[model samples]
Target: MNRRHFLMGLAATMATARLSFASTGLIAPINIPLWKGPPPGGGGPEGRVIQSHSGALRNITVPGLSILLPSSPIGHGVLIAAGGGYKQIQDGKEALPAARWLIARGYTAYILHYRLPGEGWHDGNQVALQDAQRALRIIRQREKQVSVLGFSAGGHLLGMAATRPDYRAYTPQDAIDELPASADRTALIYPIITLEKPYTHTSTHRILVGPHATASEEAAWSVQHYVSSQTPPCFIVQAKDDPRSDPHNSLIMYDACQKHGVPVEMHRYPTGGHGFGMGKTGTETVEWPGEYKKWLQQSNAGG
Candidate 1:
C-alpha cells in the first residue's frame, strides 16, 4: 500500500474503532405502529416473514417504528430505514445493526418497518412514504433535531421524505402529521436513488412501478431531481463495485445536491460492494460509520 492510501485507510480505521459492535445492554425497544386503527392500506396477515431466516418483513399492514433510546442521548435522533427492495423490510441485516450502532454513539435511533408498495396498498407507491413521514413526525414530537439514514430501497423512501417535505401521502390522521417531515441531515448508504432506466435497482423499480411505468412516473420518484436548495445536507457512501444498487445512484444524487448548492459529501470507495450494512469487517467500507460520526460532529447535525 502507498503512503496516501495507507494513511486514508489508517484514518478511517481509527475513526471507526471507537464504535464497536457490542450491543449496549439495550433497553427494550418500543414498537409502536404508525397508525392507531388501520393504516392507509388494504393488506392482512401483515408482518409476514419473506426471508424466513433474515427476519425481513413483508405486507406490513401495521407499519411502525421500533424505538431505541440510548442510555445517554446527544439530544438528537436518527430515523433509520433499512432497504428491502420494496418487497421485504430487511430488519435483521440492516436496521437492527444500524440502530445499535447509533444508540451506542449516544443517539436515539428509530428503525422504521415501513409498508411495501406492492402489497395491496391503494395508491401503493405512496405507502412507504406515508409510514416514513409518520415515523419522522412521531420522533420530532419528542426530539428537537432528527436526522435520517436509509439503506438500499429504504434510502429511496427516505430520499423522498428528505426532498418532498410538503407531499401528503394520506389525509392528516391527527396532529402528529402536523410536524415537518423534513430531515436535519440525510445519510444514504449504498442507496437506490433513481427509478430511471439503467440506473434503478431492478427489484425495487419493478415492485414499485411495473415494467410499463412511464417516464413521468419514474421522474416523480427520482430523488436526485427533487434536490433543491432547501434540501438538507447530505452524506453519501457507495463502493464502486456495488453490484446491486449501482454506485451511479449516489453519483446522480451527489451531482444534483452539488448543482442545487446543498451541503453534500460523498465517499466512493473503490471496493466493498453493496449492502455491507454497518460495513464489512476489516474492510474500508466499515469506515463509513466512523466517517458519519465525524460528519455529524462537523456539521453539528447532532444537535
Candidate 2:
C-alpha cells in the first residue's frame, strides 16, 4: 500500500481506543496531520498512540502520531520527541518530518504524545518521561530495539529518560518495570541540556522546574552535570546565532561527554535560529541531519 493509505489503516486500527478527559470535561479525538507527498524515501508515515490504562496523564497532549519503519526491518528504532518550548510540540517543524528523516535512513521511528504544560511541570516532567519509557518498553517487548530523538523540551525529556532512574510516575500493579534503561543512541538537535547555565536559566528552566524551584533541582536537571560514562552516545547540533538556547548548551554537553569518555558528535553552525527542527532555510544547520545520518552510520547505529 502507498504511504497515505497505510497511515489511514494504522489510524483506523489504533483509533478504536478512546481517550476520556472527564476530569477536565473535554473529549477530543486524536487527529494527526499527515505529510502530503510520496513516502519521503526510506519510510512512509504510519503511526498511532493508544490510550494507556494509566489514569489522567498530566499535560500530555499528542498533536499527531506517525512512525517510519526502515526500508529493511532493522531491529533498531527511534522514538521522535517533538520539541515545544515546554508549551506545544512544534509539530510541523520537528515531529513527523524528523521521524521521516530517520526512516529514510533505515531505522524504525515512533512519534510520541507525552504530557504538556499547565498540567503542572512535575506532572509534565514525569508523564513525558514515563510515556517515553513505556513507548520504548512496548516497542522492545515486540522485539524492536529503541532509542529517543527529541528537540527542545522533548530533548530534555529524552535526556531525563537516559540519565534518570526508572521510576514510574504512578503506582503499578505489575512487578516488572518494563522501562528501558538506555536507548542505543540519543540524537539531540539543539537540545536544552543545562538549565544551570545563564542562557537556559530563565525560560526553559522556569517552565520545567517552576517559578519556585531551588538551585539544587535545577542542578539535578542539567543533563550535562548528570552525564557519566553511562550516558548513551549522543549526537548534538546547535546554531551559533540562537539567542534563545545558546550553543554553549551543546558545548557543555560535548565537554561532559568527553570528560566521561562517552562518544559524542557536536556540530555548531554559524547561523540558524533556535527551533529549526530537521534544519531550515539557508543555514549550515540545515545540513545537520545529513551530517547526523553520516555520523550514525559511522558510529555503528546505521547497521
Candidate 3:
C-alpha cells in the first residue's frame, strides 16, 4: 500500500477500537479550547470547537483538551498526545486508554486533540506543537506540576515540545503562552523518534516534514538532536519486535538523554509488535503501564 493508503488502513482500525470508557471509573471530563482567540495560524474561528466524528478522527478544525479530573487528588496532571502518524489522533485506542489509565491513578489528565500537519495549516509541521504547548500552558494554569506522555507520532511532537519548548512555533496570542511548555516528566511509548533515514517511519516523516524535507530540516526535527541537560526526566518503552516503529527509536532517545546528562530509562520488550494501547492482552507489553505508574510514583517520591 502507498503512504496515504497505509495511513488510512491504520486509521480504519481506529473505528473498531470498542472503547467503553464509561467503565474507566472517572467522572465526565470538561472540554476546553486550547486557544482563547484565533489560533496563531488562522485556520478557522478563534476557539472554535469542532464536534469530532464518531468514526475515525481527521481534519482537525478545533484543537482542545478533554480534561479528566480524578476523585482522589494526586496534585499533578498529565497531557497525553496520542499518535496517528500525524494523520489521525487515535483517540479511541491509544489516547483515551492512556487518559483513563492516568485518571484511575489520581492524575488530572488532559487529552490533546491537536491539528494534523498535512491538513493545510500554515507552517503545518509546527501546528501540533503549538497545540501541545497551549495545552501544557493551560494545565500549568491550574498547577505548577504536570507531565507529558506521548505514543507514536505524538511522542515525536512532545519530543520537540519538551526539548524546544521555546522554539516559538507560532506567535503567542495570550498570557497563557507566557507559561513555560516544559514537562516535569516525560514518557514516550513506541514513538517515532527520528524524522531521518534508516529507522524513520517514512509516512510519518512525510506527513510531518514533507516527502522532500531537506537534510537540515530533518535533522532539526529529530528529537535526539535537541536533548539537553535541562530536558525533563524521560521514560521510554517499546517492543524490540515492533514492526512499525523501530527499536532504534527508544535507544536513540535514551542515548541522547545520557549524552546530555538527562535522567532517562528505557524498556524493550521481546514481543508485542506495535500500537498495543494499554498493552496488548496476553503480551508481555501489558506490564508497561504498571511499570510507568511505578516510575511516576517514584519520581514523585524522589522530589
Candidate 4:
C-alpha cells in the first residue's frame, strides 16, 4: 500500500488499540510555576484570571509549565506551545493532544502556558519568550535531549528560541538561568515566521511588535533572518489552503534552514486548512505525526 493508505490503516489500528490515560501506565503531570515568586518586570494586569474566548483561555497573568512523564522513557522531551494568535492559549485543541501524542511515543512532554503579548504584561513582547526559555532550562535538567513543538504564534516563539537562545528576555535571577535554553530540534505547525508585510500575520505582529514598530524592531523579530548553522534541525507542517497563516511562513523558514545547512523537512498538504492539529480521519495531514516519528528516530540514529 501507499504511504497515505498505510498511515490510515495504522490510525485505524491505533484507534482500536488505544488505551485511556489511566490505563496507559504513565505518571500524572506535575504543574510547576515558572518563577519562584512574581515574575520579573511584572507590571501586567493584576491578578490571574481565566477569561474564555471562543472556548479557549485568554488574558493570562501567571505563566507556568506542566511536565508529563511517559510510561516508557526514551530520555527525550518536548516542550509544547499552543497557538492563540498571541491573544490566548489553545491548550485543549493544541497543547494537550500534542502532549498525549508525544507521551505515547515514550517521550516526556511539557505543556507551556506562556504569557500573551497583548495581555497588559510588562514588556509583553518578551514575556512569552521568557517563559519558554525558563521552561526549556527546567526540562533540560531532566531530559538528555529536548525538542520544541509549537503552533501558529507559538511557533514563532519556538523559532525565536531556536535561533536566539542566548537572547535573554529577563536578567538572570536564579540558578535556572544558568542552564542552556536551546532546543535540539524544532517542529512548527502553520507558524507565523515573519513580521514582514503581506505574508505576516497582521494581528500577531501588532500584538508582538506594536502598531508603530520601527524597521529595526521588525527585522529583529523576523526569525528567518536569525537562521544560521547553529539553528536546530526543524520539521514544519502546513496546508496550502490555510487562510489564517500563509504557507509561506513555513516555506521561508524552510528555505533559510536549507541555506544555513540546518537539517530541515517540510510537509504541505492541499487541504486541512488552518489549525487542523493532527488532521481529520482520512486526510493526508494525518501522516505528519507518523512522519515526525520516523524523523525523530532517524535523528536519534545520527542520520
Candidate 5:
C-alpha cells in the first residue's frame, strides 16, 4: 500500500463513520425481498417471491419510510434512490440522509426501496423506474410538480428514467400511464450515466444486465445515449479520484447535456471517494449539498 492509497482508504473509512453518526435515528429498517425461482437470465435469480408488491398503481412501500416536509407545495419533490450497486438499496447512508436533505430544503422526499437482484419481484432497473415514475405522478397529481435525484447506481437509474422516451417498466394504468414526460429538474450525485465506454462499473453492469445479457443489451441501457434536448435541467457532483465511479461518468453526461443545449451544472471535487453520501465526514466533499442548495436558490428553486 502506498501512502496516497492508504490515506484514501482512511478517508473513505472516516466518511463511513460520520455517516453512522449523522445518519443515526433516521434510516428506517429495510424489508429485503426474498426470491423463490430462478434468478434473472443473467447472473440474477428467476422465480416468484413472497411479498406484497407496492401494487400496480399505488405508492410502493420499500424497506424504508417517507418524511414529508412541512411546507405546502414547496414547488419541488424528489424521489430518492439509495445505492447498493443495483444489488441492495442502502437504506442507512444513502436513502434516509438524502430524503432528509431535501426535506430540509422544503421538498417532499420519497425514499425508494427498489427491487433487488434475485428478489423475484421485478428487474432491479425496471422496479426502480416504476417507483420513481409512480412517485413523480403521485406528487404531481397533488401539486403538479416534482424533481428526481439519485446517487451511484440509484443515480444511474434516475438517468435512465429521465432520458427514456417511453415507459416500458410496467403496465400503464391511469396513474402510471399519465406520468409526465420528464421531471422539472434532476440532481445526479456521482451518477453512473454511461455504461458504454469510458466509465462503466463492470460489477454493476453485470448485476443489472446479468452475465448472459448481450453486449448490445448492456449497451442499450447506457444513460449517456439517452440524453437528448428534452432532458431536464441537471446538477452533478463528483469526486475526480473515485475508483468505484470514474469521474468521466459525470463528465460524459455533462457534455451530452451541453450538446443538446440542456441546462446543467457540475462540480468535480478532487477528493471524496465513492458512496460518501451527504459528505458525512468532515472532508471537503461535505460541501457539495450546500453548493447544490445555492444553485437551487439562484434558480428560484429554493423552498
Candidate 6:
C-alpha cells in the first residue's frame, strides 16, 4: 500500500486504541508555527493542507511544531521527527506513538510537522532541516535537557543535526539561532544515514540533493563522514532484514561513532523490517523502547 493509504489505515486502527491524556489531566498539544511570518526564502503562496481519509495532515506548506507535555515533568525533553522519504510525514506510524510513549515516561515531547522538499517549498532541499533546527532552538529556550528521536529519513535529519550542529540551512534571523542545535542524546530507528549509492533511499536522495546534485553536496549530507567526538551519544535500532533501508546504514554510523569516541549503542533485530517505530507487539524488536530508555539512563549517569 502507498504511505497515504497505510497511514489512513493506521489512524483508524489507533483511534480504537487511543489513550486518553485528558483522563490523566495532561495538556493537549498546542500547534506552533515554525516561523513568525513567511518562512525564510519565501514559501511562495500557502499551499493546500492535504489530509488523509482518516483526517491526518499530509502534505504541508507551512510547517509547525507542537509540544506534548507530560503529566509530571521530569525536566527532560525529546523532539521527534517522523519520516516519509522527504515526500510525506508519517506521524501516525512514527510521531504520535513515540511522543505518547515519551510523555507517559515523564518527558516533554515535541512533534515536528516539517515541510517536504518535494512540495516545492522555499529552499526545497533545506526546508525540513530548517524546521528541525528551529524546533530544537525553540525547545532549548525553555528546556535544557533535550534529546532527539527520528525514524528513517527523519533519522538522517536528526543525525545531521547531532553531528553538524553548526551547519545552517539558512542564515540566522534572530535569537533562536543563537541556541545550540545539539541534542544530549539521539535515537535513530532504521535510519537512512548515508546519501551514497546502493544504500541511499532513491526518493529521499532525489528530494534532498536533487537529481543533478554535485559530488560535494552528496558527500556533505552523508552523516557518517561528519561524525565526531562532539556528536551526541546515540541509540540505533534497525532490522537486519529490513528490505527498504540497508542495515549497513546503521552499521557505518555505529562504526563512525566508535571511531570518533562518541558513545553509541545499536540493536539489529533478526527480522522486523523497516519503519517499525514502536515495533510489533510480542516481537523482539518491541523491546527497543525499553532498551533506549536504559541507554539514556546509562549515558546520563556517565556524563
- Model-by-model lDDT, in order? 0.79, 0.63, 0.78, 0.79, 0.63, 0.77
Comparison by TM-score, 2 against 6, better one: 6
Roughly what TM-score does model 4 have, to 2 decimal places? 0.88
Give the C-alpha lDDT of model 6.
0.77
Task: Give one digit per residue, the lDDT tens place, for model 4 in 1-303.
Answer: 233433443343223222212343445567666776656676554433443433355645556676788888899999999888888877667777888889888888888878787866667688888899998998899888989999988899888998888888899879989999999999999899999876544567888887778777888888899899999899999989989888888999999999999999999988888877766566678888898899888756766
- What tens digits encode model 3's per-residue C-alpha lDDT throughout 1-303? 233432343333222221323444455567666765445665422222222453236756656787888878688889999887888787777877888788788888888878887776666677888899888888888855888999898898888888887778778787888988778999999988888787555567888768778888888889999889899999999998988888898999999999999989898899998888789988899999988998899766865
User: For residues 1-303, could you state the per-residue lDDT of candidate 1 as single tens digits?
Assistant: 233433443334222221211233456676666775566654433332244355566645556677788888888899999888888877778888898888888888988877777766665788888889888889999786789999999999999899998888888888888888889999999999998987654788888777888988888888898899999999999999999988889999999999999999898888888888989886689889889998887655433
TM-score of each: 0.88, 0.74, 0.88, 0.88, 0.75, 0.87
Clash totals, every prediction: 0, 4, 0, 0, 10, 0
| Candidate 4 error regions (>4 Å) | 1-28, 46-55
The local lDDT score (0 to 100) that residue 69 gets in candidate 5 is: 55
- Root-mean-square deviation of Cα positions for candidate 3 versus the true structure, in angstroms: 6.6
Cα lDDT for residue 16, candidate 2: 31
Candidate achieving higher lDDT, 4 or 6: 4
Model 2 misses residue 23 by how many Å? 32
Once superposed on the true structure, which residue ranges of model 3 sit more than 4 Å away at CA?
A: 1-26, 44-55
Give the TM-score comparing model 5 with the true structure, all chains together.
0.75
lDDT of 1 at 257: 96
Please tell me which model should have the higher TM-score, number 2 or number 5.
Answer: 5
- lDDT value, candidate 5, whole model: 0.63
Candidate 1, residue 284: how far the Cα is off, in Å: 1.4
User: Which prediction has more favorable lDDT, 1 or 3?
Assistant: 1
Q: What range of 10 consecutive residues in model 3 has the weakest lDDT sum?
A: 11-20
